[model samples]
Target chain A: MRKIYFLFASLLAGNFLFSQATPPPADDNSLSMANTQGLLRTQLTLTPSWMMKGTSGNDSTSISSARTNVYLHGTLEYYWTEHFSTRGDIYYFLNKNSAPGGLKKNHSLQVGCSYHFMKGMSLDPYVGVCGGISLVQISPMDFMKGDSTFLPNYQVPSHLDPVWAPRVGMNFYGQHVFHFFVEAQYLMGTYRPAIGPILSINEIRISAGLGFNFVILHKEATVRPAI
Target chain B: MPYSYYFSKLIDPNPMKKILVFAFLLVGISAFAQDRKPNKNVGGQFSLGVRSTISLFSDAGSSMGTGAGGQFRIRLYNFMNTEWFGDYLMSSIGTIGTRTDYHIGWSVMFYSPKQKPFKKYHPKPYFLTGHCFDYTRIAGNNPFYQDPNHSVASRWSSAVQAGLGFHIPFCERVDLSLSAQYMFHLGKDITAVTRTAVNGDEFLYIDKEEASINGHLLISFSLNIRCADLWHDHQKKGGARKAAPDPDGQNPKHIEQ
Candidate 1:
């Protein structure tokens, strides 16, 4: 406990020192020009991603084939100045899968800044990092009670932990109205120990999705003409 | 033997009244001594306290038994007296929604007091009786569609308890004690919210009472003040008169002596 406290204290001190030493970048001269031209249009997006998770580590002790889990991912983004924008993503996984031992559900909320490299193109590539919390539930019934004909179920503990995932993905807009995209994220760090008999398994995956954007109010086609 | 005969008669079938009488006698004696002397030296003392405890256990899946709770105490009464006490407790367990469990209960105690002025160490037994309110939350997910009815009363209830405590004093005012107790539920029937099961063949309800044993381990610290100081001045005056011997070195035995 003392060691954990000391480590946390040092990390906080380091953050303070780095933040104090760094200074904001000089303002971009082109920002004003872009704002006046009206070329800097803001875009709002909602992406629903499909995720597939796997259990590694002590897998043999549990079921033979890990079940496939399905969850939805939502994202909202604002275009700041052309290629640079910020995005916030929310993940909701509700009762995705339940076995004899316990149930596993995932709910995450993250806000981060994203940088878009391409402009005016159908394809936009972006990279971002987000931090949030993950709630996992592991029921003992999953492992304690199972049929002899079937494989033994492995159960884990119920826990809430901090989650940080860095992601790199692309957004493809085909035909201007329909859009499809895919991203691979590495779910890292276990704030607490894994529950149940499986103590070694930690990292998981959040993968792939498709979405669409509807322009509710577009910029005027042209300024009104005089008589 | 005669003292025990009289003490037993004082407590026979009327413990509360006996205690009241004991308190009154002590106060009257202190007042009488104060009228004779005005100044005397009195020492200070301390006590140690503890409580017996009980807990009701529950899970998202199963229906268990009623749980228990209690407290224990080892206290120094004065320079010469020490006490030990214990209590028994009981509580009800209920589940909220599909993930949380709540518990509530109360307790009663019994104690004994021991006095040993000449010895360096003393053993005291004490008892206490009172009530308490307890709450607990257990978080998890319910996948089996079991106990679909998630209501407050269906999730929690309260119980009552009674028990014994043993205590020993080590210093002027400090002591150590341990206790064991049992808690019984006043309400035996379980209350729960009911909902239709996924199977459609049956309904599920979450019970307010858990089926399990409630037990606990506790450590306590306490302070005790001896009332001997109330008569210190009287003792001092009596001591002075003794120094001035009468013709035959005989003196009337007063209450202060």
Candidate 2:
């Protein structure tokens, strides 16, 4: 455990040094890790996505149903390079699925890298993949045709399943710090249990939204002198 | 009277009491002085922030739940600030199911000076300690775990947390912060969730004991919207303080905007 902690500390320290050593990019077009003026490398995106499939009864899962959902998706992406960077995102279904007499609310978090194609163009297209956790909460199990022994208090039960997604998107950079993006992705695996045969449910999501990115240069080590 | 004497007076019999006294003293002493910047940093001003905390309960070694919270920070001086925050989170512990938590807490933050520590160039670091009122409820009755005779209910307890972290300025209006705090909840430990047998035939038989202490390691990320400095620059323009000229104020060490 001590060795592991030491290694982790070393890695973090190294990252800090590297970040400080790398100066902010002068040109706004090229990607730099540091957030600076015109280099608003971090982008926050909000999109209302139309899901191809939602919770429907007997849709490959006993506890799940099939329907269509229009939900809001938000993402924050940081581009470390003109074509590459890291992204973390969280999304939730706006309306709950009432397939099994319970509210089927779904939310997920994912982290991955994106590769942008055509660096200098006004429209930059990218593809990416990420793996994270997806949680499905269903409850009021009085509807389950099983013994009341497992859930004495017909309450909400949550399942956390491993999830993954592959995304392809195009970004339209405009005159200012804000831009527009449209993305399509297919998500794999849901923690929801299947009644008879298959393991879980996977989903496909497509969305378009606007984002704002700001780059802040590092403060020099020296303190500011009082005028 | 020498300021050191007042500092000595703040060192009280109880450690918690000492911290409280020290906090008040720092705030009072800095309130009357106008040497610091008028509005650039977390000095003598208030900032609002959204705090997201991932709390990992000791019962579930690797499992963690997330909380969305907001905080108000008041910078008393260059080195001290006070924060008040509240958060709510839901976590699934093993098979026992979901556990929901609501915590309201306050912390005193002590900032490190401008000098970089460990030779690693990073944002400013602060040491924090505070107390919280935590209310936790089990989402449902764990057929295998809950007390058969007792009602499935919620528990409220007092907790104290301490940790260290960084405050990174993203821009004039925004600051990004990251911190890891260890919190010990002093309350009756309820069976969070239960583990199920692979065959689903029998409830896993194990030692079900009474636990009174619950601990969690919280990692939080926050984006703070800092306000302007409390004091105006014109306060120094009166020229009264310049007449007394700070004896050792040649090149100030900590330049805070």
Among these predictions, the greatest TM-score belongs to 2
lDDT of 2 by residue, A30-109 (tens): 43222212233344444443333322223434334355554567677755445555567787767775544444666777
TM-scores, chain B, all models:
0.35, 0.65
TM-score of each: 0.30, 0.53
Cα lDDT tens digits for candidate 2, B41-81: 23566788766667787763224665566788887766788
Per-residue lDDT tens digits for candidate 1, residues B1-257, read 78978956654553456557866887787777775432212212222232222333333332222121222222222222223333222222222122222223323333322222322234455454434333433221223333233332232224444455544433332333444444433332343344644544222354556454342322222222222332222234434422221223333221100
**Which residue runs does candidate 2 get wrong by more than 4 Å?**
A1-68, A72-98, A101-142, A145-171, A175-179, A183-206, A209-227, B1-42, B60-62, B114-121, B139-151, B192-211, B231-257
**lDDT for A160 (candidate 1):** 56
Q: In model 1, which regions exceed 4 Å deviation? A: A1-67, A142-157, A174-178, A191-210, A214-227, B1-257
C-alpha lDDT of all candidate models, in order: 0.39, 0.58
lDDT of 1 by residue, A121-213 (tens): 557787755444556654444322233422245455555544456678787655323356666565542222232332211344454555544
